[model samples]
Target chain A: MKTTIHLKLYAGLQKYASASDDNHPIETGDSVREVLNRLGVPPDKPLLVFINGNRSKATSLLQGEELVKVFPPMRGG
Target chain B: MNSFIGKMLNVDLTSGKIETVSIPTEWAEKYTGQKGLGTRILMEDLDPKTDPLSPQNKIVMTSSIMAGTIVSCSAKLAIATKSPQTGTITDGSIGGHAGAELKYAGYDAICISGKAEELSYLYLDPDKAEIRSAAELKGVGTFETEIRIKEMAGDPQVKVLANGPAGENQVLFSCISTERYRQLGRGGIGAVMGSKNLKAVAIRGWLDVHVPDMKECLKVAKELHAADKIDDAEYEIYTDGTPILVDFSQESGLLPTDNFQEGTFEGFEKINSASMKEVRAAKKACFSCAIACGNYLKGSKSDVEGPEYETIALCGSSIRNDSRDRIIEINSICDDVGLDTISAGAVIAYMMEMTEKGLHDFGIRFGETEKAVEMVRKIAFKEGVGAEGAMGTKKLADKYGGAEFAMHVKGMEIPGYDPRGSWAMGLAYVSAPRGGCHMSAYPIEAEAWGDLDPYTYEGKADLVVGLQNSQFAKFSMGVCDFWPVASDNLAKLYSVTYGGKWTAEEVDIIGERIFNLQRIFNIMAGFDGGDDKLPGRFHQENLKSGPPKDISMPEEAFMKSMQEYYRLRGWDDKGKPTLEKLKALGVEDRFVQQYETYLATS
Candidate 1:
């Protein structure tokens, strides 16, 4: 079954996502990496990825209705 | 005397005596300038085991050979002292008109020793020096102190380095504020200044730096300017300042959130560069900085200088709060209180974690902006529980039973990035001479740049070591890191300005030597391989998000990487420089023998 994953950017990464891109969705079957690849987001970017409030890697298979968030390099003191 | 002012001003606060001493030509040639020269002076004069806050612990403020010259991004100064936080050599750099003024005032450095019996401010003009009573300036914040000093000096051109209540209270992470917002922020340098009972230092000058080859130097400056303009990605940094990293860090999941329990924040957009531009009243510039990154943001209540990357991350995302206005207010509070924002935020975050775990009664709920502001003020004034908070993160965590979650390296609070997420930064923090610093070796650039895999730990060791070496060189030269000039370009600039044949390789060698020297200092201070470690949380807690989900940094792999790093650095198994390596670097046998004796005992 096909699952839809929601992607959100935090802190400085919001520059890459405008109002039009809010709550942007990407499709994947199971793995998070496949979803990122399908969404055209480069995995090489300094992205901290979270799946459903827990830290997960791109290789981790996704469950349906997972809340996925990506962030850039933090500048906070 | 071609590049240097040839003299150093020694101020004895105990006796109110001020003397000008000629700098030895041999010392200048051996140590170069700024951090290098400052370290050499400290090693020669002060005992290695001297108490950091004692009157005997000298505060060496020095400018580089390039400073005050018509060189790009030379408006930098180094404040070197035994760190109260780390108990090791610490040097913090600040960018402003002050370093230039000092160089123009015909001095390469100012050596301050001993403590004043009463509060005082030093006004150093080009020809005269005075230690005046600072009765009126007592209890004043850095911003107010700067304004008052400018007014009192009767010269608006004077550059003032001032401390706030945090310093007066001897907060372990208190910073010296210069050019209003720019800080010599790490290692409690302000506490050292405060211990001296020095309220402020105001300097003014009209002399110029005599460049050996002005035409060639100017050509290089023009090239640097051109390069800055053409590089669209880097050039944008000039417009937005460091807040630009807010979005980048947030997206990368590197932004520390909820006391670094998670890597991502929910409300990053409200605190990023776009929001900053929306809130700022005007853009500001430091002395001779081509890229004016300083933002003067006006909130409803006050007009503050910034909510830079560290401030925004620590005050904003780290708490799961995204209000730019609140962040700006807190940033202003830190500036006014003369506190380091990074440490302040870390302490608050530690408190939040404690509160969440039922460890203590802090009354600080996560995302409570008002409480955050209140706590910042209280910490500054050392009021009630704020006293513990002002002592810094490690101390606060120790007061409660939260050593595992203190989020500090070498006693100083860690910056915004959670090391478990980024291995290179973790290494940088673990091995950072001044403790838990991002700027010492910002591996984030290498980690983020190009089509390389950011999540993989492959090839990070070499990049981190190289960057650390280069950053040491930058610190030695006393140049602001914002300048895009590479080491090669800098070598050419140095060659032209100093009338010396400085190749890029020679520059790298100097950097390596400085890095090793710093390592030796830390080693001599009793920091061993055991101290080169992360907090328990980083090693044990698994990352819940990102590409490396549920993967905690394996200590074995990390230790191996460190060993490889040491080997690459020409050090022994215990992370000390080998005899052959020391001899090759031209380090005298006396230092080597002393270090060996210390190592054997430790």
Candidate 2:
């Protein structure tokens, strides 16, 4: 049986989603990098990524229902 | 004796006359330097209602006191004039070696007035100034023009600011290209120059920058540079340049796709930062900058400076072209043709919209790279259908009867960031004296990262006001925005650089004064509260994707923010500065009296 996790995006990284809300699901037991890869999110796209609001490495393991968020570099005055 | 070169060179291109005047001490004290001083000088000389493209309009280029000094990122030049685009006061700041070279040439500013009878260029050395006929140099691109001028001057160090075919043809959005790549890219400064029949200004000098205290300045600069590295956001900008924002904006649903019809583009990944990194050949640096964020990308034919964040956003996703190589080509062409990337892209996007709606048949389609290239060349040359499009987005949109989706404010095309995606930026766009500008205030940093909710309209009024004030101060100092200057540090830099004892509060007061003065200039030019508005689409359209899906900017919220902003600015409901505010800033009684009359009627 396959489990699913939720993902959120902030700032410039929100464009990768087909949906409007921040509750997209990813396959469980996948690493953060794997999840992004599956969703067509490039690994080098974001400067920082977060899991459940905490900064996490791309290789970090993901569990079902885990909330992942990603942010890109800021470019405003 | 300190900081400034202490002279202004006035060149009458028509008569081939050159004159030098001593810099007024009192004026320097009041206006600070660069943008502020340039505006004050321009206001004294030109009538507010005069046509911007007329020969009577002055093209004043001023360097700040810190420009040639070892002050961090102080190599900025301000180009000020009545704007052909907005019909109001406008100035564009460009980062390059030209301003510093001008300072070294023993002038704080170069003020050029009167129309030349024929093509001409100003050649300046440390000890001499001459007006030379530019017949031989006509029809050259900016890069070639700069190289030719340097060859003529017999110095590789000679800095040149010139126009390309776009400016030569008086394209309304044409830019004054400086140091080959850097540009005074807004409000059609190049068109103003072109109208004067001025082709270029080349200068070389060996004079040193005079600093009051070199050791103290160096110490502060080192500390600021160090702090900038630790600031992850600033650090990334240094490494990746602005193209890094491409991925984020795409993912965040603020990429401005299909003439801003959609919030995101499908082909974003192919043209983003990672791809840019793969093609980047070397890093480039501007004068006195530590962060060296500029990247030189190797093209199949030639190496070119990057399509930065603004370029990528405007020329790529905004128009649905996702090929990085094509974007790079577009960027190089804009530079060569001397057109602003933002305005050019906006105009092209408008053309695409017109084509899609069957308004005209110009063979422009989304993702048509070859057509885009041809259009750029045609616009530069003012040939065929490109002639109408060359007039800029506002005029082109008006011609096509699509002013509703033009995405311009005060006749200038807006930048890449969609206002509906960022309310404070939207307000900044409308109220900016120069029209549709991002440099006045960038609220995205605070809006995204501050404790306040990014989606909420609450407290955005204060946020926009603060950012505007700070940006004014930054420009007055003539430094790059990438510096890590907190309020306290900025106050210190101002005091030390100008010999004025300024607290952060005092600096903020100066900022408020400059901002209000610019507003007064615009008001006198006939813009008012009603003119302070965004495009209809931003106010009505819903985001088709992203977290803010189905979200449209609320008119009521925007109005409330405007009200709060006006109140905070001490301006009345009509957006006129209050008498008390002017008096508090020590503005002269004569101007204050005139403002009072305007306010009473308003």
Candidate 3:
């Protein structure tokens, strides 16, 4: 069974991958961390990854068809 | 004198008399001037039961020993009094030229008490102090009043701290605006100022804030200036301003939306930092600060200094209004009307939710925000529903019946953080002396995204307690909250500016002592461990949308952490400072004996 997840990079993280290149798709058995690693986001930069509107992690396993979003950390106010 | 003016003015508005008094050296050494010393004065002089809006309530304005010095982020003025909203020891921090100017004018602090017979303003020059008739300035907006007073004083550099129309009407959330942008923006200090019938305090100075070692002070300052630029990569507060947090918090599930019913707003993209970056016309900073995280925006609504992260959360996302331009305009209006944007937004959102729940409507809907802008003026003037809403969230909830989800702690509205998303902030909010404030201890950097896990209570108690102590100590020195300065750095700066080897450990102890002192003040004023809890909505209900869906604070974990935090503070399980704890913190038993007495009675 072939299944895939769509990845959208936002804000400062867009420097890695943006809509100009369009979102890349990852299949089942691939985790969010795998996608971030491919995009060159450092593990220590406090980046937040959300899978289909839920707080996910770099190590979170994708369940295919999930919309994975990534961005820099939030602070203040 | 090494930055110690050692003098304060006591103005009794009712008698129209002003007296200058010497600030004892021992008191200055123990409390470090600004927030710490101001709290000590309030604890000693004020009756805990005094009505915050009454003549008995006193407003003490002081600067830290660092003010007017070359130290980075050193110019801040601390305003302390019983909050009309929280009924607790509230200290509002104002950043701008005013704090340093007040110091340069040869006074370390100004204590204003009693209600005046008529409207007036305090005029302070380097050599003279007078209470002048401000008949023409009555009921004017803060911006115009500051400008008028500056022109009247004939000094373009005169620093004017003025209350706006909202303060005149005594709005519980009224703020004191300074330099047209910086504000003592929380805990209703302006209402206390207005109640005294004092319109503004304009200061001009011709002296310098002498430091013990100017060479070493400038050297440390240069290092801080260089270090602040390093934070630009992770926080980027300088480049994009605060709106940058919008998208990140939304995705991370911390952004409060629709009166905190949800953790994310779908309308986020339209009003996030990218939009603020596009509209930011200029960058601004307060006093001699280097981080420079401030911005002035020219959006479709108006040209103003930011709808910061909090305003963006409350006005932009909380009510489902995603128009960045409108939010910017609303921020400007809020400034002019003297309303703290956090409370203003929260109260309006409460009314909007009330309308949703079949309560009385002021024609407010989830996504409709234009009406609230009009109500901003009405709130200042005390007109229409603004009369009820200006009373703030707790009062509005009392009138309308939403006690469970009023979203306030001790009458102050909660800021942008949805505690469900950043669990440590829940503890911070509960433990804060001035009710629901995020500035007290922002633990999200560590607990939410840094080393510690955000889900469990494992290290959160230690994290929050430590942050609170450090922050309290930092603010005691009138250090601006925007920059990141380690405790060691603070101690070195203290030693260089003041005299002596003020160790980092001593600074920590001073912070802890100040925290306990404020707690003792609250204890006498009737706060207990019982007050250290969040709104029922946060504990019982769950966030309905986004990454933090249906997640609520775990009861047992929260309780465990709270208890541990108590132990760290040397407090009992009920959050009262034990007599032994007071002794260890160097708080004289006589100072806290009243609180101990209050505990015995209850």
lDDT against the true structure, each candidate: 0.77, 0.77, 0.82
Colliding residue pairs in candidate 2? A12-B248, A12-B249, A12-B252, A13-B251, A13-B252, A14-B251, A14-B252, A15-B250, A15-B251, A15-B252
Q: What digit string (tens of lDDT, one per residue) describes model 3 on residues A1-77?
A: 35666777655566677622333666677877776777787756666667777666777887677887776654465
Candidate order, TM-score descending: 3, 2, 1
How many Å off is the CA of B292 in candidate 1? 0.7
**What is the per-residue lDDT of model 2 for residues B102-141, given as tens digits with 9 covering 90 to 100?**
8888888889998888888899877899887787877889
Tens digits of per-residue lDDT, candidate 1, B458-544, equal 777787788877777777777777775567876877787777778777676667777777778888877866787778887788767
Which tens-of-lDDT digit does each residue in B375-430 have in candidate 3? 77778788988888889989887887887778899899999989897889999999
- Evaluate every candidate with DockQ and list the scores: 0.11, 0.17, 0.36
| True-vs-predicted CA distance for residue B303, candidate 1, Å | 2.0
Q: Is the docking of candidate 3 incorrect, acceptable, medium or high quality?
A: acceptable
TM-score of each: 0.88, 0.90, 0.92
DockQ preference between candidates 2 and 3, better one: 3
Q: Report the lDDT of model 3 for residue B156.
A: 87
Q: Name the DockQ score for candidate 1.
A: 0.11
How much lDDT does candidate 1 score? 0.77
| Stretch of 10 with least lDDT, candidate 2 chain B | B227-236
Give every prediction's interface RMSD: 6.4, 6.5, 2.8
